[model samples]
Target: MRFRKRVLLYLVPAFVIYSAFMLIPLLMSMRVALYEYTGIGDMTFIGLDNFQRLLFESPYADRFINAITNTLEFFLYTMVFQNVTALLLALALTRGLKLTGLFRTIIFIPVTISILMIGFIWTLILNPNIGVLNQFLEVIGLEAWATAWLGNEATALPTVAVVNAWQYTGLMVMLFIAGIQSIPEDRFEAARLDGAKGWNIFRHIIFPAIIPIVGIVTIMTLMGVFNQFDLIYAMVGSTGGPNYAVDLLGTLFYRTAFGGVGGQVPQMGLGAAIATMTFFYDLYVCHRHALY
Candidate 1:
């Protein structure tokens, strides 16, 4: 009984914190999602009307659809360019690179920078008028390639997605590196003795060993990609400007909950509905993937 009491002392703080920060908010959001409530007005219990309107009857259906699709595109881009590239880098680093420590630090530096700062920095770099990128293009006689990266609807979403991928690639790199380091070196030696080289070694040995780590990385990337708001919010503002080119579900929730420059009146209920649905959708995707 004394030992159990001691164990409870250690667990109680964590339980309290989790309940206060995560569990409480999750329950509150689900409850709020069923009501018609603005920030100021009293809430009215409306059953699933908010969800019905959001999915089938909302005037902003088209925009919401676009946001959902854009978010998926962003996730795909990250999976391919960021996570895959990070895995490649980690693999390369394992091939007896000398300055491994320096390289790791340099790669991870961008992740240490604030998301807002990275957005502002990239904004300055990609500016059409006087940005360094355009100037560099002009100097190199590639002026035709220089364009307003964030302003043009065609390039805006992809550009922001790439920017976000760039910032987070280092995190995936570190994850991959850790997985690679934990691998048994004897396995590589055995493969080397069997004349397996290059892609064969990686495919047959290293790749198989890292499947569990890949699952973890995939789930984390899924969560981060789905919940992405900071970088887009910082770069494109709350409105997701230039014709909502880079709008995401996160931004949609924010815009709905709080009226923006060119948005509708506060629809806190609808915003909560979107939030609740998206949270579960992401959870379901991750859970389904994990189960398989």
Candidate 2:
């Protein structure tokens, strides 16, 4: 009883902070979604009307759908590019190569930098007219392949996705490395003794041992992708330019709630509705993952 009491006491501060920040704000947003508010004057209660408008109305529905599609694409890109690359890099780093520490530091450097700064830097690099990337392409006789990466609708979202993947890949690599290192050395020794090499060792030992870490990385990626805003905003602006090709739920909610985009009247209730839906969807995904 005393030990349980001590544990509960230790948890109280964290639980309080979490409730004060996360839980309260989430409940308030859900409540706000059931009303009509414009960030000023009076708020009118309008049970589920905002959700109805968001789902079935004209412009709102279209933009919401677009944001959902883009967010999913962003998550998919991160899973494929970021997680895969991290896994590969982690595998390589675990091979006891020389200067592994230096390589790990280089990979993780980008994660320590500001997302906005990274966005600005990449924007300069991807610029069509004067960017280093285009200049390099020209030098290599591939000038025809160089184009307006951030300005073209076809490439804008994918380009931003790649940038995001680059910024966070290091963190994923570290997680994977930790997972790989946690595997018993005896397992690898046994595998080698059994004539297992390279792919077989990884398939039979590393991969199975790190399944939990993979799940953790996937959940983190999913949450991060849904909450992605700053990098996209810094790279493409609040309107998610190139005709909103790069817009995600986070950008959509911010623009609607705060009127960050030109000529957009702030719709606090509708923004809250968007947020509420996203929160629930994320919750559902997390719950499903937990069940599995």
Candidate 3:
């Protein structure tokens, strides 16, 4: 009874904090979206006009579609590349090889750095004129292959996607490594005794045990990638430049609420609408993924 009370005591404050900070704000934002806000005067009661405008209006409608598409594209690219690369790294590192610890550290190094710093470093690396990447390509007599990576509309989004994948793959590798390391050594010994080695052992025992961990990693990566804004914002600028080819929902929401220049007076109602839509979309995605 005392232990239960102690646990409840700790949980109470945590719950209160979450409710006050996250839950309340989310509810308030939804409420704000349902109402219409003007700069100075009282807010009017407009049920779904904001959403209709966001969906059916001229400029806003296009922006909304672009934002949704860009965000989804970014999320998809991150999940596919990051997980595959991380899994490959985990497989290689988990083998009882020399210098495993050093390799693990090297893989996880990027995850330790700030995303903003990573963005800046990648931007310089992908620079068209003075960047080492282009310089190396030119030296290799493949100058045509050395076009501006972040500047090209065709490659900009994918370029950012690769950078994001590179940065987070290390963290996923570490997670998989932890999961792999937790498997019982006796299981391996038994498999070896049963003439089960190499891919056979992995396919049977190691793989199954890691599925749950991978599922967790997948959900986390999905959310992180879906909501990603900082790296793209930093590397490509907030507008997701090159004619907004990289314009993600997060960036769109920012630009919409707080107009780009001259503090053109924020449209809290529209911003709230975008945010509310994003919130629901995220909820649906999370729920769908959580089921598996």
Residues 139-215, candidate 1, lDDT per residue (tens digit)? 99999999999999988888898898899888999999888889898998998899999999888888888888899
Which number leads on lDDT? 2
Which candidate has the highest TM-score of all? 2
Candidate 2 pairs with clashing backbones: none
Sequence-dependent TM-score of model 1: 0.94
- The predictions' CA RMSDs to the true structure, in order, are 1.7, 1.5, 2.5
TM-score of each: 0.94, 0.95, 0.89
Candidate ranking under lDDT, highest first, comes to 2, 1, 3
For model 3, the stretches where C-alpha displacement exceeds 4 angstroms are 1-9, 38-41, 190-198, 261-265, 289-291
lDDT of 2 by residue, 87-201 (tens): 9999999999999999999999999999989999999999999999999999999999899999999989889999999999999999999999999999999999999999999
Quote the positional error of residue 125 for candidate 2 in Å: 0.6
Give the C-alpha lDDT of model 3. Answer: 0.85
The digit string of per-residue lDDT tens for model 3 on 120-239 reads: 898899999889999999899998899888888888888899999998898899889899999999999999999997889889998899998888887887678667789888998778
TM-score: the better of candidates 1 and 3: 1
Residue 196, candidate 3: Cα error in Å is 4.7
Instruction: Tell me the lDDT of model 2 at 114.
Output: 98
